[model samples]
Target: MFRQMFEEKYMRFPGGRAKAATFSYDDGVKADKRLAEIFAKYGIKGTFNLNSLLFDCERWHGRMDEEQTFLTFYNRPHEIAMHGARHIFLNKVPLPEAMNEILQNRVYLENRFGRIVRGLAYAYNGYNAEVLAALPALGVAYGRTTEDTRTFALPEDFLRWNPTCHHTDPALFEIAEEFVKRDPAGEFKHREPLLFFVWGHSYEFDDADNWQVCEKLCARLAESEGIWYATCIEICDYVKAYRSLIFSADGERVYNPSAIPVWLELRGRIYELPPATTVQFAKEL
Candidate 1:
């Protein structure tokens, strides 16, 4: 009997690595300048969520001006995401108002940065059924919350993407230690990819006078083996591309329709499927 091992395939990050790390920080404040430098030093990437209406607005407090924004993020390997137009609690407002805030914020960012902004960080960690339902129509690919899951697991739903922990979590270092020490290939059921997502506001460091916390954390994770440090949108795009792979009838061959390449592990054999190419497998392992 010819057996089909369609269910035996597994997905990996860009370099065939099963572990990834991404960071998200909210509010465009001066502290982000230092944070950006720290991330650049470690070769890490993250997303900076900003309120479009707050930028260079005299009435707003602690918001970065256009010049400061350029100085902080221009040369950095980071992403810009919407955090509402005025940091409004989306769910508290009407659905149209929420969508308008998101759209205006996205438009302003796109105009300034010349890139389509697709990620969102809910202002005040607030959202409801209505706001969530309208995100896709407004062009948001994913939304982040303040909730912490405290584990290195990918989100089942990207819209409610809860991070592993905030940077200020008391066990931040311990959790980072766990992420670096765990081996995904050690067990069969745990063979899926793992992600360590950390989210917070850079201004929090100034309040606590603990910039060293992030400095040390970045040092701990910098250039670790088998770890793909990416921005939130990068991770989202990679996962989506991986999921879009198509399999042949017998599952011995696969096609990657997306423009991004994807890695797969089939019956313990690793394979890289380039963009728009089909790969046929050898005899059963």
Candidate 2:
């Protein structure tokens, strides 16, 4: 039974998908319309971080022309998260001001977007221990930073969620190629879940005049049978749900407490644990 359990213990994403890919774009801007269209065309999903205070201002850091366009562009199949109220550097600001920056933006986003704002990509990728310590009380489930790991792996700390790469990374295509070649069923196998998280500002594509970079990257990863394309919040929620699962003393049964369904692989077979339910596994020795 011990050996069987060891062999069966594997994590599978929704629909038995072997890998997950998510994108994060900071700063709501006019260029997001084109970027959104490209992502939608390729069936890719991502999270857009917006500064509520800068939504429609005519200033240098202004966002889209109108709030309605922003809403319509990312209403479904994507997420809208906070990027601070004024897009200030949290690490440099006083703790009270930093807290206000996050909470104010959260409230405005929740009211305007009509969804709970549970995630944030730090403005200017600025954060510190104090900021991390205060996030949970403000209802933030996860926070993304600009630090790139250049690898496909789940975050060790959601509060400081380091992304895999920036969209403009010179080796973007090479990384995508490496991600695509990781076949779960091949001899060279990885038992753990793989997550490819890319972050950047959509305006960069326009500034660089290299929209093809994103187009090609998306094309290389789009419609992959074994890959689950998700928004950043979706990825965080799914992983949280998976970790919330409770196991019986003998490992014969399990309970899921989260509202989201959890997937797991047992003895090379995938099992879905529906939300708020328990399931008994067949004994194997």
Candidate 3:
């Protein structure tokens, strides 16, 4: 029985980490600079959503000039994602308008950052089925929503991905405590990869005068031994690569066709499969 358990095969995150935690913040507001600093202090990774049209736009408080600041202050480890060109409500708009919002913003962000912009967090978390369907063709791989699941499981559909919780979720501390207490090495019925995805707008911290909420959350989640701290796109790309792996008819050999390497847990050991490479494993009975 011990040998059989050792022979069991499953996908593991990079570095053999048992879980991942990522953050998503929307709107390219000035407050994001401070938020980014906080995240950096805690070694947290996140994706920042920006509306190309909103850059340098004046708000009731003052002009934000995010176009210049984003290029200067945003950390390289984090990602820049689209939040629509005009920050319009997609669910309320015509399909063409919605498409234009996403496509135009994607083009601008790609050109500005010199990185392929493939992730989106809906403006106002306002998207319908049509909006979701239009994303893939626009080169978007995942779209995050505002719906809070308050659980640590990976999303079934990336386009409609719901986060584990919002930063302000009344149960935020409680959930974080539970997440930290989970012992991945111990036997559990659910052996799938765990993800704690937190999403919110950086401006909210300024509004509520509660930056400490984020500070405490990050401090608690930082330096977790078995957790992978990653951006949304990084997590999505890795999972996609893992899912694209091919196995032989007898399941003794596996081929990785993706450009990114994939990790597999077999018999209590982690193995790395290089890109465009094949790995053969001993069959277990």
Candidate 4:
């Protein structure tokens, strides 16, 4: 018999999906236009981390203009996150300087896009403990780092969010293959929602002459029916909502307090827990 009482309670993505995939591309560059097209073609969503000061800065031909940014991402199934106001290394500067960099970028993006900007991809993957602690007060919700963990695991800390791998990792397709085949319910030994997060700069494809990397990855993920394509912010928000669920002492009922709907797995059975509603399970622990 299954050890239902001892089994860990797991969660699923929207629509009761066990697997979810998200991409993060840094820098608002000319190549992002092509990258956005590839994502759109595959019906995938991702986040673009941009440095507002770099727009039309003319330091190089690759920098995108405000109009280019809007045309590529506006009204699209994607997100815009901060990469610092000037794309400087946050760890090297004073704490206030680092904060200003993020705040200026957030303000510009919010004013331009007419939406609250709260996510970040560190400029140069640099940050200190103080800067991380300062993010939430700055209205930031999650931050992405360049450290590639090479595993399908949810982050322990959203402020220091580490992705599964970079797009250019040699094991990119191998990892995607593993992600596509795994059935979360079947893995009784380890049952948790899987997140395949990939992070990179769009201009790297142009520099390395490897645009096929993005195309191939997108096509592979798009073919999978079980994977939920989501933006970085959406994933963070959903995870928060899932963690906010209140449970009864007997573990037979749960209430989702957040506005987002959640899917809970109890003893291998999946249950849809709607926002602000309580769900009672047939079996008690």
Candidate 5:
């Protein structure tokens, strides 16, 4: 039973033990472009959460039309999703106002980018159950929250495991290399090794300490062949796929994604997948 839950927690859509780590860049534009370029070089894909209002700020930033154009260009490989209109905290505002932020932004983004915005990252990761219920009506299949207590967040249901924005944690990043190479054996022993989710603003890649830590962690993730690097969207779909398959092969399933988190056994622990599955990390062009 524990193994079943463990496999369920880490299982991706289709069903497999593979771990994936996603690289997401929020706010949009040049930094978005740079992050895409870097990930592309490594054959990885990412999710770009955009705030529609800020696109107009290109002119204000002294770029004079460069902002929107730059974002339009970089948006090619990444999935362009809504990032709330004003970055407002949903808990503080009235429901209509908060829902409008998501609905309006999805409209503006579709008009500009021509893609259906299905995923969202709550500004500041603040939300209540009421907010979640409203998303489906607004055409959002899933959204992420600001939770990273573990390497990954499991679904309360298979339909949702959207880790909105993975907070940047320096502690893990600082020792990733040392931990992966040596610790995976003893100090870092877990039946199913982690698929680390480290995130931060792409523009801040210039920060000396932050950059080094991000670089170090990325290197470790790359070196560790067991884990899969994936974006939150990819994770959601994968989890959804996994659950649906278990319930039915045709992809019709009613279940939560977090019912499974990890499995511990005499061998210690390891990830488990359902009957059939392979979580893909590439993006649509």
Candidate 6:
């Protein structure tokens, strides 16, 4: 029911349409040192997805440069989150194994970093419906996947069925359809998040051919309107804040944020949410 309603309300663009992009990386390797250095040099906040057990201060893949920066990365507070224990794909394994994989990594991080990590990215690019539905219970707020099907992703719970009715990245077939629709003979509308999410190995840059593609891609990703490069935790906060103002009703949906009554003040009379909620506080287009 919610998905149906979600599909109805947001199938069209809100207007001239707001835009955004999020760039992220996967697997913790020494290459990450250069990645972080480059991003930090440019003030671009790259989301570095990591596995808790991978950083061992030992050598692997030719270099003796295993990092102990798990302490630094997880503790930095900008962006990072769980990437499944041992980078295993939950969908490829049984439920208990999958859950344990995620949990072991999570606990490992918390124990080392002294704080909770509530985001995830399944390893091996594998995921199933059940793994998703179980996230809320496992202490994950959100996680990342490797799909780049060209769509602005909205969480399932927010759509009418979830609420936003945001369509999944229309992948191969949809891309073809969108191409036909846009020019009827031209190219796809690129109705996707302009901030295309791309990720893969750092060593890929080591190859002459692969490095050429990566060079052109990163060079062109610069956005003049400004791009807020962020990590997994930072992204989770934005999502939570955005969702706090959106809700669903019936098959039709409305953003009656102001209608939801709530106390205006929490602590020393500073924090508050007035009874008559309005879209005034919502993120602007």
How good is model 5 by TM-score?
Answer: 0.68
For model 4, give the 10-residue run with minimal summed lDDT: 1-10
TM-score of candidate 6 on Cα atoms, chains taken together: 0.61
lDDT of 1 by residue, 1-285 (tens): 123244677788887887899999998987788888888889899899988777775444367898888677765689989999899999998889999999999999888887888999999999999888989999999999999999887877889999999988999999999888876755566677889999998888988999999988888888467889899999998998888899999998999999988998876667899999999977667
- Per-residue lDDT for 190-251 in model 2, tens only? 66778899999888887789999999889889845689999999899999888888998887
Which stretches in model 2 have alpha-carbon errors above 4 Å?
1-5, 57-62, 68-74, 185-189
lDDT of 2 at 272: 92
TM values, all candidates: 0.93, 0.92, 0.92, 0.95, 0.68, 0.61
Better of 2 and 5 by lDDT: 2
Summarize candidate 4's per-residue lDDT along 107-189 as a digit string, tens digits: 99999888888999998889989998888989999999999999999998999899999988989999999999887767757
Those runs of model 1 whose alpha carbons end farther than 4 Å from true positions after fitting are 1-7, 56-61
Which of the numbered candidates is closest to the native, going by highest lDDT?
4
lDDT of 5 by residue, 1-285 (tens): 122321122333222333456765566655455566666656566777777665546433221133554455444766777778776787678889989999988998787776666878777777788887777889886776556544444565522344423435545654354334532323322433344455556756643335554455555666675455566666666555544533334322323333433221222233243234432221211
| Model 3 lDDT tens row, 168-276 | 8999999998888785545444556678999988888888999999999898888467788899999999998998999988766899999988988765556799999
Instruction: Provide C-alpha RMSD values for all models, in order.
Output: 3.2, 2.8, 2.4, 2.0, 8.3, 9.8
| C-alpha positional error of residue 33 in candidate 2 after TM-score superposition, expressed in Å | 0.8
Candidate 4's displacement at residue 193, Å, is 0.9
Candidate lDDT (C-alpha), each: 0.86, 0.83, 0.83, 0.88, 0.55, 0.48
Better of 1 and 3 by TM-score: 1
Model 4 CA lDDT for position 96 = 90
Error of 5 at 224 (Å): 2.6
- lDDT pick, better of 1 and 5: 1
